[model samples]
Target: MRRHARERPEAVALRFLADGEDVVTEWSYRQLIQRVSSISRRLAEAGARGERVILLYDSGPEYIAAFMGVLQAGGIAVPTYPPMGQRPLSRLIGIIQDAAPRFVLSTARTRDTQARRVAELSGHGALEWVASDELPTRESYEDVPVVQDQPLAMLQYTSGSTGSPKGVMVTHANLLSNCETIARWLGPSEGRRGGMWLPLFHDMGLLGGVMQPLYSGFPLLFMDPMYFIQRPVRWLRAISKHRLTLSGAPNFAYELCATQIPDDELQGLDLSCWSEAFCGAEPVRSETMQRFAARFAPYGFRAEALSPCYGLAEATLLVAGKPAGTRLRTFVSPRQEDGGEASPEAPRELVSSGRVVHAHRVRIIDPDTLAECPPGKVGEVWVHGPSVAMGYWGREEESRQTFQATLPDGPAGYLRTGDLGLLHEGELFISGRRKNVIIIAGRNHHAEDVEQTAEAAHAQVRKGGVAAFPVTAGNEERLVLLVELKPDGRRTEAEVAAVREGIIQAVVAAHGVRPHDIFFGSVGAISRTTSGKLQRQTTRQAYLGGVLPALKVAP
Candidate 1:
């Protein structure tokens, strides 16, 4: 950042959009550095150096400036979402309790309200509050000296899609290594512009959206995640308006734009300038990408722009991704893995998440046998690279188990990603989460595959809102599905019967397993993590507890 300030002081470092069209605020390199320095001085004066500081801010330049400020003041930054009304506040309180930060940074507009809400739930009233947006800036400012010895730069909390959120210890070295690898993967950035609506608190949002652009020496424009969710077309509109070369989101975002946006709203949409439509943070479905590309192809969108990638917070945002404008690699495998009737004609198709980044090693290993799986075999994905984080914070036993695992005869220090995938021709193809795999009748089945088929079976079923899991009933495990229906009036018994029959028939036909039961509810019935990943485990627990808001249940 200092280098950029010295070299390109007048260049725009960041821009924020209120409506995703009109620019609300923008910061030059010089201005950003000055704001960062000012915040750093205030933090340092308040004895924040060498302490953990929690940052809670809406999307804007204040969040970026405060993040750099925390690093400049030699403090470890812990970024988490700002709590909103009626939303799950437990995640935020859980992160705060786990990180144990000394100070909380936010704009004056949100500081008091958030602090009050957090204190009521967290009981951490001693945490100091710093209004970063209200800090006074000087005309000419010098960078504050940061401690060079502290290896931990930030604590990136996991999204907790399956369990409790754990803080992944990210070092300055991890940030630099991943950022450089991303820059290389994206190729030259000359004349490139970046845009995003992902939450700044998430790893994909902070590292991929913010750090990558900064490392590549390009300007970025962004808006609140809620703003984009309210109207996803705004994301594409911003890209077209600014002629952005790089922008992307998870598969759900693409699905939303493809299905929700009207033709009139896309009258003048042009996406030719969108070169890198990177997708990650959740499963990337080929169907979603294909629909999005075909829907907007007439408006200059290219199929080659759909880049599917894979990574987790433990690996510091990016593990493997394809270069822009490359042909997507896909693989075909048997739909049923456990010796069911094999159909050569209807094999399941999977998309590759490109190759492992330069200088990184990826291996698929059978979790139970502790042996490496041969190429094209599904197993747990293990990653070893500089981009891998130190470990989970304050959980030495788990950290050692997850971050220090060694192969029987292979290398040590490989991160056990807990994700299942395979390598075909040097490209990684994710299958599903190791814990989320449902086994029934001695056959292995991925929950996502079942959910996808079930969701597609009925038009009334909400896409990306189905959860498939196993429940132990009597002496055997039975497959069960919790589905979310589209928002409509109350359904009659016949309509409910039709929805249930569609799901059972589709899932059985596709995967050769009949759902023991199907539960239907309204939209938002399925729980999601902070990054919008479906929480199957949470949903299952809710089902078992009889707390799920089911409009109808089919036996």
Candidate 2:
């Protein structure tokens, strides 16, 4: 950013589209630097240097300026989304408790309301608050100190898909390494304007959406994530309107675009300018990508532009991604027979998340044996690279276990990703999560596969809202599906029975296993993390505790 400001002071560095189309606010390279420097000076005066400062704001330019300002002031930035009405305040309270920040940076519009809410909920009202937008801009002539090894830059909290969100200690070195890897993978595409609608609080948004553009010396256009949810075509239209060469989201976003968006609204949509549509933050489904590409192909969308990648907050952001204009790779795993043997009759397609980025090294290790798995075998995905974070904040034991893992004879420094995948022909194919895999009849099945199958079986079963888990029956483990239904008129018992039968038959035909039970739930019944990743464990607990709101149950 500093280099960009020095070389191209007048070039537009950032643009915020409040309506997801028209630009409401923008910042040039020089203006951005000046704002960041001024905010840094104010924060330093507030005794924020070497302390943890929380950043709370909606997605916009002010949040970006405050983020850079915290880094300039030598403060660890903790970025989190503002709590909305009826949305659980527990997440914010939990983060506040875990982070224990010295100060909070928010907009004047939300500081007082949020401060009162936090004090009422968590009883932590003594923390200082600064409205970043209210800070006066001042010229800064002070030279930044040159440090070979910089300290912690930020704490990226996990989305808590499996457990409580932990703060990933990201250092300046980690940030730079990930940014460089992303830039190198994207290469030098001409007219490389970028756009994003993902939340700035998430790693995908922070690294890919915010830092990557500045690092690559390209202008970025962004909007609130809600705009995309309210109307996904706005994202495509933004890319078309701005001629953005890079942008992407999780797998479900593509699915939503294909299903929710009407054909009439996409009459003149031109996606030819979208060069790299990277997908990550969740399992990338081959069916979803294919459907999306086919649906938008007439609008100048290319199938090869879909770059399926994989990474986590612990690795800063991206760990692997296909180069632009490369062909998508997928692997077919044979279905397991009744006796737990591979059967070639039924094959499950898995999309490859490209190859490791830059100089990073990846290894597939058996979780129990602590030994490397052979090629083509699914195991825990472990990564060792410069982009990997130092460790989790205030969690020495967990950090050592998760980030300092090692094989039997291999050197240390591997991060145990707790994700199941295999390396096939230099591409990584993710299978499922380590703890979310369901075992029934001595065969291991990915929960997502079952959930996807169930979702496709019935039209009423909501897409991306099903959770398949294993429950202990009398003498064996059985498959239980918690399904969320789409909004529709009241259904009779006959209708419910038909839906349950359809899901059961589909699961049996696809995976050769019948669902032990099926619970039909209303919309929003399934629990999801902040970033929309399904919390299967949490859903399972709700079911076991008899608290899951089920309109109908089939056994």
Candidate 3:
């Protein structure tokens, strides 16, 4: 990367906007190389060489500089978002303690708290902390290049939905391969500009916003993720203002932007330059994409710009994506019937995430036996390639289960993605999660199938009301449905009873899962991540917290 920057010193590498105005802060390839060198020397001076260094800062020029600096200084980088203040400062301290990082680099406002917490966790009198703003400069120093095959970076903590966050160790070769594959799939030409508001802590954000641009020698535009959540249209406006050729978000982001942005605001926006709009990180809803495109198409947004892709942190960000400049493909049922078997044809109900990226080996396997399933047969989706990460940092058991597997043709060695999906004519179609599946009466039931049924049963429960989780008591495995009522609308006991019955009946009819528990609570009671994924474990914890009320149902 340093060599590439040195070769193209005069090219613009990064662009950041502190304010909403058109004025921007730019960094040429040469300037970036110089800054990274200086920061790397400072890191070495702070005793951070060949050691793990944790970075806690918002998205900005300094954040990128610090990240590059850590790698350049022969140290591993563990980057995370700033504390949200919900959890005690001890959480961050515990992570630092577990990793035993040599030093912590953070913004000025968080330096004291971060240092104090680290001290408490380590029980040391003092700890090393550097405010990103106050780091010293370095006079020309030799660049220490790391081996691409060895671990180049470490992302502490998984998505945190399942259990304790595990640090995913990514190798330089893994990172570079994935970025190059993504750039190739997107066809990022010279002078191509990409805009992103996803947090750098996330794989998608870090790889797409930072590494991709650097590897492709294109300029990347960055903004705070919070700002995009608060005002999504601002993302589109930013693309228009910067003539951004590529941008993307999870499915919910597009839904929020479509639902929140007013028609008048949409009328004034220009999105002609937007060429590649990758959507992933969550289930890609056909309705969400169609509505978003329809609502914004008049503003010069092309339907061909929508690129639905799939990836994960374990793969160093990218794996499979739709080809650039192609309209998204949808698999629809050929029959006009409302609920029909999904076929490869472009039916009204079909939704496709486009074709797979180059060089990625994706196969849908039977979850129980690990045998390759034929096309259109839903099963666990497994991918094997150079993009796959080395393994979890300190978890051998989990690494073995997730990162090591036996294929029929090769010696057993592949990552068990744990995601359920199928392939049809070379396109991957995700179904649900293997862990989240609920088996009732020896029949397989998907949580999304039950949740969607519940949503359709009552308009009040339409998005906020339902959660389906599998539970085991003794020898029996049962499904549990937790529903939250609308906040402003007060429901009588009869209404509550009706909702409970409706949910149970809906689930049983749709997926043959007779939920053993139908728990109801207040609206906004269900916890979810920033991306709107239901925090089932958190809800289960809350249930165990003794906050839910019991309701009697007819026998």
Pick by lDDT: 1 or 3, better one: 1
Clashing residue pairs in candidate 1 (N, C-alpha, C atoms within 3 angstroms):
none
User: Mind giving the per-residue lDDT tens digits that candidate 1 earns over 1-555?
Assistant: 888989999999899997666856889999998988998889888987779999988788889989988988888999876766432366678788888889999888778677787888888888899988777885666646755777788999865321256789999999999999898888888998999998898888999999888788899999998788788889989998889989988776888888889999998888999988998877666777778889999999998988999888899979999777989778876641321122222355777899999768999888888888898987789999999999999999999999999987777899998887889998999865656667553234667767878889999888797898876563245788988887766567788888889888877666667898898866777888899998776777678777888674333
Least lDDT summed over 10 consecutive residues: which range in candidate 2? 336-345
What is the TM-score of candidate 3? 0.76
Give lDDT: candidate 3, residue 150: 30
Per-model C-alpha RMSD: 9.9, 9.8, 10.3
User: Which residue segments of model 2 deviate by more than 4 Å?
Assistant: 86-88, 140-150, 161-163, 335-346, 436-555
lDDT of 2 by residue, 1-555 (tens): 788888888899999998787856889998998888877888878878778888989899889999999988888899987877422255577777888888999998788687888877766778898998888876652464322333899999876321145789999989999999988888984588988999899899988889999888899999999899789999999999888888998877888888789889998899998888998887777888889999999999999999999988899989998876989888886641211223233366779999999979999887877778787877788999999999998999999999999776777989988887888898998876566556453234667667877899989888797898876554235789988887766677788888889999877766667888898887778888899988776677678778888674333
Q: Candidate 2, residue 114: CA error in Å? A: 1.6
The global Cα lDDT (0 to 1) of model 1 is 0.81
Ten residues in a row with the worst lDDT in model 3? 336-345
lDDT of 3 by residue, 1-555 (tens): 566665776778888866643657888777777777777777766767567888888788788888888887767888875665533243455566556676777878888655665576556434567776775454343453433433566654454321134678887678778877887787747757889988787777887778888877778888877677677788998999889988898877887777788877765678988888888876666787888898788788888888888777787777677776786777653331111112222233445666667677887788777688888777777878888887887788889888887786954557777776667788876654556555443233556656667777776674756787755442234677787655544457777777778777765554444678877766566778899988765665566566765433324
